[model samples]
Target: MNRQLTNSKLLLKPASASPALHRVLTVPQLWGIAVGLVISGEYFGWNYGWAVAGTVGFAAATVLVTIFYITFIFSYTELTAAIPDAGGPFAYAYRAFGPMGGFSAGFATLVDFLLAPPAIAAALGAYAHFLNPDLSPQWVGAVAYVVFVSINLLGVRDSANFSLVVTILAVAELLVFMALVAPGFQLKNVVAHTDSFGWSGVFAALPFAIWFYLAIEGVAMVAEEVKDPRRSIPRAYLLSIGTLVVLAIGTMLLCAGAGDWRQLATIDYPLPETLAMVLGKGSVWTSLFASIGLFGLVASFHCNTLGYSRQLYVLARNGYLPAFLGQVNERFRTPHWASIVGGLIGLGALFSGTTDQIIIFSVLGALVMYIVSLLSLFALRRNEPQLERPFRTPFYPVMPAVSLVLALICLLAIVYFNLLLSLLFVGLGAISLGLFWRFGRQRINVHLTTLGEAERH
Candidate 1:
C-alpha cells in the first residue's frame, strides 16, 4: 500500500482547498534567522582560538578564512534561488541523487537540528552562571528549552520578531563592550601567544572553527518562507555572514585588548568576564547587558529548532518518512507537532550527556551536512543543465569544488581529533539509510500498484 502511494504522482498535485505552503517572511526576518544561527555563546567559546589564529597565524590566511564564509553564502544563495522549497538539504539531494540520497540528507539534517537546541540551551545555562552563580545548570537549561519552544509554538512571525529583537540587542551589547574596551587596545596584547601554531594545533582547532561558521547555511533552510526568496535569501545570507565576521573579529580584538591571550583562553564566557574586569564587579549595568547577549544566544537556538522542524516536515511530505509529520497547524500555520517532536529530542539530549560531549557531536554532524550540501550542488548542476535559476553561482564548478575540498579538510580534522563523535555520526547515517530503504521500497511498491489499478479501470 505504501509503495503504491510512493509511486503515485496523483498525490503530488496541489490541492484546491490547501492554502499555499510558502509563507512570505520579510528580509529582516530572514536575516534574523541567519543571525540566530551565527550569534551564540558557542561561537564565543569555540571559535575564539581559530579566529585569533587566523588573524595572526598568517595575515593572508585570516582574510581567506573570512572570505570563505562569504563565498559559501553566495553559493548557497544560488541553490536557494534555484529551489526555494522547504525540504532544504532534502530537496537539493532529491533533485541531485534520487530518493535514497534525499532521505539520508534530510535525516542527517534532522539529527543536526535535534541536537543543536539542547546544546545551545546548555550553553545558555552555563553562561547564566556568570550572572547568578548559585543557579543549577540543568534547571537553567530546562527553563530555556521550555521558553524558546513556547515562543516558536506561538507562531513563525512571533518567533521571527523575537529573534530580530534579541539579535539587535545582542549586537548592541557586543558593540558596547568593544566601545568601552577599544581604548585599551594594545599591540603587545594583540600579538600575545601562549601556544605555538603548527599543523597539529591548527588541525585541533579546525572543529572548533567550523562550529563557529556552522549555521550560515541555515538561511537556505527557510528559503520558502522569505518574500522574493531569490533576492532576499542571497541578500540576507551575505549580509548576515558579513555582520557575523565583523562581530567575531571585533570581539576577538576586544578580548585580546582586555586581557592576556592565556587568560581569555582559560575563561569560558570571556565577554562577560572581560566586561566585569573593565567595569568592576559592582557594575549592574554591564551585567544586565551581558545577560541580554546570553538571551540572544538562547534565542538563536529557538530559531534553529523552527528551521529544522520545517525542513523535516517538507521531507516527510515528499515520501521520505511518515506522512503525518507533513501536516501543518491550521491555526498557527506552523509545523507545531514537528516542532514539539524536535523539542523533545533536544530535551532528551539534555538528559543524555554532558554539554561538551553534545558540542562535539553537533560539530561533527554539521560538517557532514556541509559536505553533502556542497556535493549536491555540483550534482544538480550537472544533472539539470536547463533548469531555471534565478541566481547562478559564479565560477560554478570551481567554486563548489573548492568548497568540497575545504569541507573534506574540516571533516578529516573532526575525525582525527574526535573519533568517537565521528563514529556516532557514521552509525546514525547507517541507521537512516536502512530505514529509508525499507520504508521507501514499501512506498514505491504501493505507488506502482495504484498505477496498475488505474490502468485496469
Candidate 2:
C-alpha cells in the first residue's frame, strides 16, 4: 500500500516537465531517409539467395517477399499516421497489448535496426578493399561506423541531407550498373545456372530474398519528427516501397542475365564483380562501380544507425531501458547518447564478420515484430474502433491479414533453413523478457500511470 501510494505520487508529475523531440523532417527528407535505410539491400545480401536457391528459385522467393512487404507497408501506414512515435512498431503494440508487448516489439526492433549496420559496414569494408586491396575490410568497417555515427550526432538535418546525397548517388550507380550489364543479359544464363536445390532452395532462400526489401518499415520510426505525419508518412511509405520494388526486380534480373548467377551469389561486392564480368576486369567502369557502390552501402549504414538510435531513445523514453539512453542533445537537438551507445554496439558486432549471418539473425527480429504488429492492427480495430485514423489501410483487414500470413510463412522458411540463428533469437528474446518482467515492469508501469495522471490534471 505504501509502495502503491508512492507510485501514485510519482504518477502525478506534471506533463510540462517531459522532454520533447524536435520536428524538422519533411516528406522528401523522409523518402531519402527511408530509401537510404534499405537501399543497401539492393546492392548486396540478396545475391546470396542465388547460391541457396539458384536464380529462378531466388527470384521466386523474392516475388513472394515483395508481396509481403507491399502489403505490410500499406497496412503499416495506418498505424504510423495514427500514432506517429519514434517507437514505430512498439508504439502500436504497446497500445494494443500494454507494457510487456511494447518491450517485446521494442527489443525485436532493436535487434533488427542494430544488427543491420555491421553487415552493411562489412560490405562497405569489402568495397574499400576492392579499390585498394590493402586496407583491411574490418578496419574499413570500423572507420565507417565512426564517420557516419559522427555525422548523425551532428544533427538530424545534416544526417538527412547526407542521406539524401548518398541515396541519389546509390540509385544512380544502380542505373549505371544496369546499363553496363544490359548488353550481356542473356536469357540462357539464368536457365543454365539453376542450382540442384530446386524448389526447396526457394524456402532456404527466403531470408536472403528479404534483403531486397528489409528495413524499409524503418521510415515509421521518424514519424515523430515529420512536419505533417498523416499526409507525409503515408506518402513516404508507399513511394519508397514502390521505388525499391522496381529496383529490386530490375537489379536481380540484370545481375543474373549478365553472368553466371553461381559466381555472383557468394561475393561481398557483387555489383563491381558483375560489372567486371561485363566490362572486363580492371576496367575504369569496374573501378567506378567499386567507388560509387560504396555510396549504396554508406547510405544504408548511415541511415540505419540513425534508426537504431531513435529506437533506443524510444525504449528509454518509455522506461523500458535506461533514461540516459533517451536524452536529446540540447546543442544538436538529436538523441546524442542513444546514437553513441548504438554505434558502440554496432562497432563491437563488426567482429562477427559474416554478412549473411548478421542479416539472417536481424531478419528474425523483424519477423517477430511483424507478427506482433499485425496482431496489434487487429487488436486496435476491435478494441479502439473510435480511435482517430487519418489514413486507413485500403482493403481493410485483408491487407494486414495477408501480410501477417506471408510474414509467418517467411519466418518459418527462414527458421527451417537457419535453425541455430532462430534458436538464438528465441533464447535472447526470452531472456530479455524474463529480465524485463522481473524489474523493468515497475518503471514502465510508473511511467504509463504518470502519463495518464498528467493528462487528467
Candidate 3:
C-alpha cells in the first residue's frame, strides 16, 4: 500500500462509494449557474464603491479588477479542466503541494464561500423589505436560507434548474434596468460627479470592484457534476465572465448617470433607486423593479450555497474536516449536512447587519485563494510536466503572473484600507489552520490508509 502511494496515484483515488454528486448540469445550466453566483454583485454590492471612491474612481478600480479577473479566470479554467475536482483549488493545491498547502487553499475557499452568502442574504432581506416595508429584513433573509437549503437538499438537478430560472430573471432584470435608464444616461453626469478620492481612494474601492465578479469561479466547485467538464467548464467560464463584464459596465454607467452618484452609493438596491430617478420615486415601475430585483440576490444566495457545500463536502471527504460533513443524503445525493451548516453560518453573520465588513472579509479570503490557486498552476506545471492538461492557459507564465501581481496588489490595498479587519481575518484564518494542522493531521493519515486498503482490494 505504501509503495503504491509513492507515485501519487493514491492522491487521486476516491473513497469507496459510487460516483458522488450527480452530473445533471448541462452547458447552458452551467453558464446560468456560473452567472447566477455573481450577478448579485453587479446589482447591489458594487455600489458601495461610490461612497469610497466616487463613480470615476470606482470605475477605474473596476476596470483594473476586470483585467485581473479576465486573466485569472482564463488561467483558472485550465486547473479546473485538468483536475475537475469538487474541491476546486483545494484539490489543485493538494495535488501540487501536499497537505499543508491544500489546507491553506481549502481554508481560503471555505472563507470566501462561507462568508459571501450572508452578504447576499442581507441584500435579499433588504430587497424584500423594500418591496414590503413591514417585513423584517433579518427574518426574510433567514427564511431564504432555510428555503434555499431545502431546495439544495432535494438534489443537484433540482438546484441547477432553480438556478437557471432565477438566473434568467436576474439577467432580465438587468436588461430592464438598462432599457429604462438608457435614455437618461449622460456622460456629463459621471464627469460632474467624479471625485478625487486619489490613488488611495482607488485602492480602497478594490474590494467593492471585486464584488462585481466575486464567486464566478464557484462554477468549478461543481466540476464533478458537469456533463462534459473538459469542454463545458471552459465554455461556461468564458461566457459567464464575458456576460458579467458587459452587465457590470452597463449597470455602472447607467446607474451613475441616472441619479446623484451619492444616492445609490451606500444603498443595497442600487438599480431600483436609479430607476426611481427616471421613472418617478413612487412609480409602479420602480416598485416592480424592486420586487423583481430580488431574483439577482436569490440567484447568488442559492448558487453560492451550492458552491459552499461542495467545497465543504470535498474537504471533509479528504479528511481536512469531520468525516460526517462529507456524508451525502442517500435519497437526494446532495451534501445536505454541509449545506445546512453553511446556511446556518450565513444566517449568523447576517445577524450582524454589517454588509461591508462581511464583504471585506469575504474578499480577503478570495484574494488569498486566488494567489494560492495561481501558485498551484505554476507548481504543477513545473513538477508534473507529463500530467495531461486538456487546456493550457493561453499565455502560460505571463497570464498567471499578471493574475498574481494584480491579486497581490488588491490584497495589499484591502489590507491597507482595512487594517484591523484584515488583521482579524488573518488571525482567524491562522488559528483555524493551526488547529486543523494539529488535530486533523491524524485523521488524514488514517483516511489515506483506509483508502489505500480499499484501492488494493
Candidate 4:
C-alpha cells in the first residue's frame, strides 16, 4: 500500500470503470498545448496596463509578475509531474487538503480557463473588425467558437497537431512583428508617459501584466495525456515559460518604443495598430501583419477551448460538477459534452462584456488559483515527503513562499482597484459553492471516507 500522496485514486471512483484520457501527447505537442494556450496574450490584452500605468509603470509591473510566474511554475510542475491528473490544481488540492480545498482551487481554475477564450474571442473579433471595418467583432467571435469547438471534438491528437502548427506560426509572427517594429522604436517614445500614474499605476496594472502569461499553467490540464507525465510535463512547463517571458517583454517594449504607447493601451488589436503606426495604415506591412496575427489568436482560442473542457470533464467525473459533462465520446475519446458546454459559455461571455473586463475577471480567478495551489505545494511537502518528485522546485520553501506572497499581493491589488467586479466574482463563486454544498455534500463525504479507510488499511 503506497502511503505517499502521489495520486487521488482513493478519493476518485475506481478509474477502471471510467473512460480514460488518451496518453498520446509528446513533449512537442505538450509544448504546443502550453504555448498555444497563452500566445494570444502576446497578441493582445496586456496593453490595457499601459492605460493605467503608462509605459514605464506597466513595464515594471510586468517584470514583477514575470518573477512571480517563474517561481510559481517551478513549484507547480512538481505536483503536476507527481499527480498527472486532468483536474490539475483541483487534483493537487484534493490530495493535500481534501474536498473543500479542492473545490476552492478547482472553481478558480475553472473560471481562469473558461473565461480566457471569450476574452481571446473578443480580440479575434476586434482583429477581424480592424481588417474589414463593417465586420461585427462579436459575431465574428461567435463564428470562431463554432470552428474551434468542432476541431476539439475531432480528437486530441488531431487538435494537438493543429495546435503545434498554429503555435509555430504564432511564435514566428511575434518575431516578425518585433523585427518590423524595431527600426521605429525610440527611447523617447517609451519614456513619454512614465509620469502618468506613478507607483500606484503599477499595482493597477498587475492583472494586465498577468494577462501576458495567464494560461501557461493550463499545460497541467493535459498531464493525463502526456506520454511521460513525470519528465515530459516538467519539460513542457519550463519550455513554455521561457518562450513566453522572452516574447512578452520583447513585444511590449518594442511596441511601446515604436510609437505612442497610449494609442495601443485601450484597444484589443494593439499589435496591428502598432504596426500601422510604424508602417502606415494602408501599407502592405500593416495588412499582412493583421492577417497573420490571427494565427496567434486562433492558436490560443483553439487551445484554451481544449483546456476549459478538460477542467469541466474532470470536475464532473469527480462528482463536483454535473455528471453529464464528464461523458467522453467513445468514438473520439474526448470530453465532447464538456467542450460544447464550455464553448457556449465562452461565446456568451464574448458578447456580454468588454475584452478588458473579461480579462480582469479571468486574472482574478488565476490569482486565487495560484494562491491556493502554492499553499497546496507547501502542504504536500510538509505532509507527504515520500511522494515521488521527478523535478523538485530549485529553492524549495523559498521559491514557493515567494510565489505565494506575490500571488497574495496581486489578488489584493485587483480587489482594491476593481471592487465592484471583485464582488461580482465573489458572488458567482459563492452561489456556485452553495449549490455544490447543497447537492454534493453527501457524495464528497462518500469519496473521502472511502479513501480514508483505504489509506488506513
Off by over 4 Å in 2: 1-19, 452-457
lDDT of each: 0.68, 0.85, 0.88, 0.90
lDDT of 1 by residue, 217-263 (tens): 77767666678887788778877888888886777666666655555
The CA lDDT at 338 in model 3 is 89
User: lDDT of candidate 3?
Assistant: 0.88
lDDT of 4 at 327: 88
Worst 10 residues of 3 by lDDT: 2-11
Instruction: Specify the highest-lDDT model's number.
Output: 4
lDDT of 3 at 49: 91
Model 4 steric clash pairs: none
Instruction: Show model 3 residue runs off by greater than 4 Å.
Output: 1-19, 453-457
User: Candidate 2: TM-score?
Assistant: 0.95
List model 3 lDDT by residue over 1-457, tens digit each.
5332422443454443624778878888998899999999988889899898988899999999999999999999999988888889888888778887788889999889999999998888888888889998888888989999899999998899999999999999899889999988888888665755777889999999999999998998999888989989999999999999999999999988886778888878788888888888788989988988989999999999999999988888777877778888888999888898888888888997499889999999999999999999998899878877888999789999999999999999999989998898889888988889888888777767776676779
Each model's Cα RMSD: 3.8, 3.3, 1.8, 2.1
For 238-300, candidate 2 gives per-residue lDDT tens digits of 889988998899999988888777888988889888888888997998988898888899999
Error of 3 at 19 (Å): 6.6
Order of quality (TM-score): 3, 4, 2, 1
Give Cα distance to truth, residue 431, candidate 4, Å.
0.9
